[model samples]
Structures are given as structure tokens and as C-alpha cells.
Target: MASPWRPIRVWSPLLGLGFVVALIAFALQLSSRRHLAQRLWTFEELALYNGTDERLPILLGILGSVFDVTKGKTHYGPGGGYHHFAGRDASRAFVSGNFTGDGLTDSLNGLSTMEVKSVVDWRKFYMERYIFTGHLVGRYYDSQGKPTKYLKGVESKAKRGAQLLEKQKIEEDKIPSCNSKWSQQEGGKVWCDSGYPRLVKRPGDIALTGKISQRCACFKEEELGRPGLEVYKNCDYLSQSCSV
Candidate 1:
């Protein structure tokens, strides 16, 4: 009769403590799930976040590398020009300029020089513009998701090609101008001695001097206006006889 509710009141502290512990446990579980989501995602899981649901982010893959393109949803989302590339590697497609499913692969075999260069350019573009997530485990990667030999080869080729391109540019800048000159009477013209080497014989090869096969005509100014155009405009220098 002192107080009918006294017993329940005395146990209130314990019940409150239990509730606090349960809440903390639930919070920890939620945090762990969030962390897992931010970690590496498999290709199948990536496809689930293709911006189609409006709840997940938009993502894309290139050469086995994944990127978060959510920031570019306007261009990568549904009905966007690049929507087809989302949630897939599609490295070959980028290089071959093929937007079909058949091009959605990482295989670099049989790609021409320009195509390979295109793939390299696309890789640089993604790296500079998007957030890198992880790699895909198909075509460009092995079962365990490690980079495959083919991928490595393609990368090596890209690097080598870039280096070669840079070198070629430098060499081109150093080429001695065929000392081209302009004359009103003859129009623009360039005269090469009996022995003069070509500026470029093959791709990336430095120009080497060669003996003249025959006395050639002076090149017209208009013909020499473009690089390597003079070679096709050879004529008898004495008479300046050649098709302009």
C-alpha cells in the first residue's frame, strides 16, 4: 500500500539502459553496411546502381576500370547519349567507335593504331573527369579480377604509342625547312640540290638525305605550302617545267 507502482518504477533505469544498448548496436550495423557499399563493387552489383532506380548512383566502366559518373547523370543517365556505356566495361566500344552490345568488351585484339589511341584517350578522359571506383572482373581482368595479360599489353602499347607520338612531334619541329622561298615570276618555290634527303621516309623515322634520282623541277610555292607536298610537285628546275 506504500506505493503500488514503486516496483515498476525501480526497474525503469535497467529498461532504459537496455534500450540505449540496442540503439547503439543498430547504429553500428548501419554504419558497417554503408562502409561495405563504398568498397569494391562487382560488375553485377554495379549494374544495380545504373541511375535507373533514382536511388542509386550512375556508374560506368572502361578498360576494366570503374568510375562514378553520377555527377554527369545528364549525359550518362537514361536516355542520355552515353547511357549505353553505363554499368559496363565497353573498352572496345570506346576504341572501335561501336556503341552496340558487341563492342561492350575489354578485349583489345585486332584494334588498329587509331583505335588503340582512341582507347588510350578515353581512359585519360575518364580518369580526369570521373571518380575511380574499382575494376571489373571480365575480359580485361581475370576471374579474380586482376588485370589480364591482354590488358597489360594494351596498356603497354598505349604508353609506347604516346611516347613515340611525343618523340615524333619533337623531331618534326626540328626538321630543316626545305629552305622554301617565294618568287613572283615563278610563284612560291623550293629548290633542292642534287643530293637532299627526304624529311620523313616512314612513320617516326628521321629524315635522311638521299642522292637525287634525276634533275627535278623547282617546286611551286603553292605546292610547298603543305608539309611533304613538294615531293609530289617535282619538275625540271631549269625550265621550271612541272604541273603546278
Candidate 2:
């Protein structure tokens, strides 16, 4: 005869485990909502947490996102090396390396697409290293904590920068860069071990930056005369090497 205890033994563990998982998931969701609720901080409020007062936690802002960097007190405190970056959104300075006076501003104006992407990358670095606290209500975000048009534009440029970088990597794999060297006695020389050296438009340079950029690359004989490829000046069309 089948015993009732057998059914309890089979189902009890599964039911208990399911209940525990549901409880943990609910707790995580609630915690996330609480954190997100802390969004929308004014610049003045952010400035108060610059690690001057022991009572307040050290905070830093980047790309509108604020993070609790209290654990890095040695690096962000009043006398720390990165103190200028604390309690302010100096997004541009991440790449500009100008951390004083006007350079500490959050303006991304006139920055190149790749520079803007570098600023975004710095934000990602902080996000992974510190606890996210809130959003700063200025240039990058509105008082209601929504992204501003300027912020959206920066993100779009950054995305384009990433695409450009990927395209460049693909192009490099297809046409590897040529080996090069320079000397006062020998001038400059570029060559390939197995293919001819040619100059080609840098991937995405003109479209993204409106500047025509080119680089020397090695290409197989059959790959010559591609749309962007041009023979080096003073070098034979099929020569594997060139001097500059």
C-alpha cells in the first residue's frame, strides 16, 4: 500500500524551497524600489556629501548618476587625490584631465564622440566599484529624474563611438596594420610580411568626426584597389614596403 508519508516527503521539500525563493525575490524587488526612490537630488544636496563632514557619506556624481564612494575615503576625501571629482559631476574632466576651476564642470560641449564615450566608460567604472545613490538634477537629468535632451545626445554619440570602434576592429582583422619604423639615417619605412602596404580611410572617421583620417595597412594582392585603399606615395603599386 502507498503510504501518506511518502507523498509528504516528496512534496514538502519542493514547496518549502519555492516559498523561500519567492520570499527572497520579493525582498530583492522591494530593496531595489527603495534605492530607486532615492533618485532626484539637487546639485546643492550633492555638494553636501563631499566627504568633509564625518556624519555624511562621501559621494561622487558622473553622467548624472551619483554613487556612495565612502568606502574609498582615502581617494575621495577632502585631501584625497580625486577630491575634486567628489560631490560634483565633472564628466568632461574624466578625459580632459583638467580637474580645476572650469574644467570641473559637467559640460560635455565640444567634446568628441570618443571623448564622450570615455566619460560614459568612467561612469560604468564607478557603478561597478561603488554603491549607486541617486541621480543629480542638472545638465544630464531633469528635476523629475528623467534624462535631459543633452544627456540623450551624449548617449547617442557614445553608442556611435562604440559602433565605430567595433567597425575599426573588424577592419583591422581584415587588413592588418603594416609594420613600421623611423630613423634619421633611414627616414621612415612601412612594410608587410605577406601583403602590400597601402593607405586606407580610417573606419568611421569621416562619418563620425567629419575629418578624413587614414592609416597604413597590409592587404593581399587580390584585395588591392578596394574603394578606400590607395597606394603609398613613392612606392610601387604592388610593393610590400614603402618609405615615408
Which structure among the candidates has the greatest TM-score? 2
Best-matching candidate per lDDT: 2
Q: Residue 131 in candidate 2 has what lDDT?
A: 87
lDDT of 1 at 101: 62
> Can you tell me which runs of candidate 1 are displaced by over 4 Å?
1-40, 143-145, 176-202, 205-244
TM-scores of the candidates are 0.59, 0.70
* lDDT of candidate 1 over 79-129, digit per residue (tens): 999888887777788857788867776677777554676787898898999
Clashing residue pairs in all predictions, respectively, total: 6, 0
Sliding window of 10 residues with minimal summed lDDT for model 2: 29-38
Candidate 2 per-residue C-alpha lDDT over 133-236 given as tens digits, one digit per residue, 9 for 90 to 100: 88999888897889999999999999999999888789678768999999999999999999999998875776556678889888888889688788888899
| Predictions: Cα RMSD each | 12.2, 10.8
